[model samples]
Target: MRKVNEENERIKRRYLKYLKAAKRKDPSTVQKAADGILKFETSTNYASFKKFHIEQVIKFRDRLNEEISKTTGKPLSKSTIATILAANKGFIFWLADQAGYKQRVRHTDADYFNMDAKGQRVASAVRESPYPSLEMARHAFNYMPEVSEIDQRNKALFAFFMLTGARDGAVASLRLKHINLIDGCVYQDAREVKTKNSKTITTFFLPVDDEYLTCFIEWVTNLRTEKLFGPDDPLFPPAEINVIDGAFKVVGLKREIYKNANAIRQAIKEAFTRADLPAFTPHAFRKTLVKWADTHYPTRQAFKAFSQNIGHSSVITSVSAYCPISIEEQGELIKKKKKRNEDD
Candidate 1:
């Protein structure tokens, strides 16, 4: 089998660059789109896309349903298939307008990459799960030991997530100057913070447990006052490792910020594990806050403010994404209503 089509590779690279620089999609998203294109390339034996026929593409789409997923050892889930197909759909649509490919690739040909109407509806359906409760977050934060500097930092990290509902990527990139204990908020500057859509948001301390809030404040204060960290210093700096007595030990904090969210995600998971709770990602805290606010916000204005505080420009984004009532909860609600009617 021919390993590479130089022409296809060049075009794929161009599409990926366009996705990143022009469309502002992140590298991870663009990579997945690349993967989908690669899958198509592999199946077609690196056939030149300029010679793409509707019949070949339609057969390829049918074969997609037959392909087994390595992760699950089954056919790809509806959603996964939709995502893979959609990537090709997007690419082909773009190819139709590109200089060399315009003569062959048609807008109508790209339309074949789409899943059937019913399949798309099924793929887009959202599944609900139990998000961590505020009480559980408080317990986990309190349960974390403060014996070591690393412990203290990890504790503060959890508390900050609970208070601000900031994404893990943004948390990893936070600077000492971004947080204000007196104002009880943090400034998530997208230019620095790796926020979704590069949004700059000011998130206030959510009215949760006081001790958890204190944990967040004390850690920030310790860095500023005792460690003498400048405004440029990392809020939760990367762990400093040193060889002590011929053994590697996590001695203290480094001045460097994490290049990614992996460390923060691992720390929070370990924190939850220690507390004997389900491992929730740092992003889960945002959902916890959103679920809580859904009940408290009586007016549309209040909801909008809450949404904007969490960096969402639209209120429905919060409501649709976070306010999912589970099937079990729905049944319980119905049962309670029935009981109330009988009592009355």
Candidate 2:
């Protein structure tokens, strides 16, 4: 069987470039879309996408539901199906409008990619996630042993996340110069940092009383004054590897930030696991920050400032994305409001 359709691959590449340059979708998004198309093609044995049929779409939808995740060994999730279907739908819709295939495929055929109503609900449903509370985050930070460079880095990683509530990618790309202790903020300069939507924002230090922020400042200062690292040096450098006798050994750290956020995510997982907590993803910290702000800051201006700190243009976006009130919590809050109304 043909491994891939060259024509389809070429057109897909063009579409991906369009998504990146015109649509401004991130590389990760483009990659997921590309994977979805490739998976569909693979299932069809790389048959000409120009001759795609509604039957093929129907078959793929059913097949996707039956498929298991290679990593998790569990059935593929509704969210995963949603993304894959959306990708394929987009590709086919674009192809249907282009020359050569315009006469063959109808744009409406793309609608077949929609999952059933039940499936769509499952795909779109928001579940109450298990995120670490601020207190647990503080405990994790304090529990981290800082005897060696790696330990210090791990401690600093947890500390910095608590202090700034910055996304892992932005944190990974930060430089020593990006932070100003005097200003008590980290400026996520878009040109230098991998921020969401390439947003440039300043994160003021959180009022959380953990001194890990101080430790982070001390580490960067020592690296600059004592180690003679310049302003451009990575804030969180890579682990140092050395040849000890014959075996390769990790001694301390080398001056380099991670090329991406994967390492930081793994380190976070390890930290949470060691703290005897369920593994909460780094992104969950964003939700935690929002939850914290909601409890502490009641004024509209305060919420707006909180939204800006997280690089959101509006509070609505932040609320919609991160401030989902869990069903149980919603009921409890309603009961309290009712009780207060009765008293009034």
Which one wins on TM-score? 2
Judged by whole-model lDDT over C-alpha atoms, candidate 1 comes out at 0.88
Give lDDT tens digits, candidate 1, residues 289-317. 99889888779999899998899989988
The TM-score obtained by model 2 is: 0.94
Q: Rate residue 40 of model 1 by lDDT.
A: 88
C-alpha lDDT (0 to 100) for residue 214 of candidate 2: 81
Tens-digit lDDT string for candidate 2 (48-99): 8777888898889889999999999999999999999999889888888888
Clash pairs of candidate 1? none
Candidate 1 has a TM-score of: 0.92
Badly placed stretches (over 4 Å) of model 2 are 341-344
Q: TM-scores, in order shown?
A: 0.92, 0.94
Count of clashes in candidate 1: 0
